[model samples]
Target chain A: MYLVEKLGEKTIELFHSIFEIVQFLLLIFLHLVNPKSYNPAMRMVLTKQIYFTAIGIIPIFILMAIIFGSVVIGVVIYLSTAYSLESEIGSIIITFVVDEFAPFFTALLISLRSGAAINTEIAVMSVNKELNTLKEYKIDIIDYLFLPRIISGIISVTSLSFLFALIMLGSGYLFTFFYMDMDFNTYKYLLLNAIELRDILTLIFKSFAFGFVIMLIPIYSGLKTQNHYTAIPVSVLNGMVRLFVAVFFIEVLSLIIQFF
Target chain B: MCENIALIKAVHENMSISEANTLAVEMLSMIGLQKIAYKRVENCSKDELLLVMFIRALMTKEKSVILKLPSEIIGGLFHIENILKDMRKVNTSKEIFVCDLVSSKAYYKECECHIEESN
Candidate 1:
């Protein structure tokens, strides 16, 4: 019941959904292959790209990481110290905050802000014929507009997630020392012991994929749309739902791939 | 025939032509229009006009709603006459509609979507 057969065709459409997933990968590849096609105002694209994904997300991502990190550190430190398992503190911080929570949380925050903006902005452009107008002016709309967004999104999500992960680690450290018997050196030792090259790679991939899926899905939905002023809202809603699903899907899939 | 007309009347009974147009587009599927395309007497190029016909076409559960549309629709023909020609060309599906009306004729309704039914 999740999907109604439009024109008696829901199952096949789901199959076609895979193509939608590949559209961004294709865009990125094409852009790289034909760099000359996008030679108009490359500076503007880069600036807007960074500004949208990185700068706009700094304040909120920092705040969330700080608060969430503090609470987590406080709880973990208290529990570990109380149970005399304080040595396990570093593993908990590395596994829970760094590997799992911080990256996902940062990705979610960036996704919601940047993803919604991409989706809604593209939809409005589609509605207002701005996309059409771009074509009229001999601009490669996808090359300049969407390609930069995709690139910046991946870069920003990875970097920003890394930054917030550090912030969370610091916050965790603060809570442990001030609120528990743990010293700064003990906390630092715990964290350093948990560091592994694979963990960082996993975190980076997850962040980038999350950001990529979020923005790409919306772009697909906006382009596939035909006039239903009503359909714009529906497309956006569908995009958001699919985005969250994709995020969770990546988490599970990555875990499987790593295990194998 | 009677069932189709009844459905149309029911679709248009208390609604304005514009309202009927919206209902027409919403109701028709691509297949439904394909099976009955040539029989369509009116070809609606304007989305507003096609929308009313589409709403009327789909409002009824009756299988023959497209074949007999007179009963469901009422007296707005005088004002909506320009659009009636396009109605004749409709195939009763979303493909042609999207190609002809939804994609080409889509204009942001600058005004409140108005619909009046004359029950």
Candidate 2:
């Protein structure tokens, strides 16, 4: 009976969290579409966010992409050749690396880095009453704070995913050249032939969803923090855990959609 | 420091960035702290923090300002006279009201601002 009660409470908590996130998403969408929300302060914040979350991480991101991309592409090519499925190398890379791995890996990295930072920032702002300082002067916290971070998250994830895909595809060619003795023209032709419009659409949609939730979950978790200093780390932990769950959920959902 | 004052105008009033920054600098100059325009919050002295908060309050476009326990907010020894002198230098028409404990009423006795005593 005690176990049953605990399970019921967990289920209710899960649904309540989902409902709150959806409501917050709707509010963000409303503010996103409104031009007035892009005041100078918001624009400045958005620019800074983009620079911090995207541009600042580029060198590390590219380095990781090159190393990870080479290993994955090398393994995929070796296996495909072993099975005498060399002709299908392009489709395999597209299906696995571009459509599946790029956005997922990028989101995870961002969630670990920028997402946690944003959670801590908002939590600290709340605890310090800096958010109240803005409120006291009629400044919209949603416009000045949340919207910019969320938008930057979306932009960073989407663009970085595309860049990851490019890097992986480039590294795939290098593997083919060094190991398989395949010519650039042939490799290019194979990739171009295997590429389909749906793959591109899926990448975009999946990246968008991943980006939205990564930022949204963290900000939501941060706002959940109690107005105490100790609560900051707790909120960041909650946000990171929830962000990973959301990222995996999106990836799985996208795969299921592709399967059908 | 100045951005704290400028943010309200930039966000709420949709003012341009440079214009808002210029206005913020001008306001800081009013309190003779314009040199700290680019200074970060942590590096500020308690008195500067209090004045920055005061200027931020003034940015609200409210016709009157109520300061709730100014000395406690500064978190150190401060004279109500100096703060009032600074406020007067800013030269705004806003009505200033200082609210403090009745026990602390003696502190504001020399200041030229009105004080509301509460039992």
Best by lDDT: 2
TM-score of each candidate? 0.63, 0.94
Please give, for residues A65-144, the per-residue lDDT of candidate 2 as tens digits: 99999899999999999999988988998998879999999999999899999999999999998888777777888899
The C-alpha local distance difference test score for the whole of candidate 1 amounts to 0.63
Error of 1 at A97 (Å): 1.8
Query: TM-score of A-chain in each prediction?
Result: 0.88, 0.95
Summarize candidate 1's per-residue lDDT along B55-85 as a digit string, tens digits: 4444444454332233133323333333334
| Candidate 2 segments whose C-alpha is farther than 4 A from its true place | A1-11, B115-119
Tell me the docking grade of candidate 2.
high
User: Candidate 1 on A179-254: residue-level lDDT in tens?
Assistant: 7757888778778997888788889888878767766777776776666577778778877787788888988898
Clashes of each: 38, 0
Q: lDDT (CA) for every model shown?
A: 0.63, 0.88
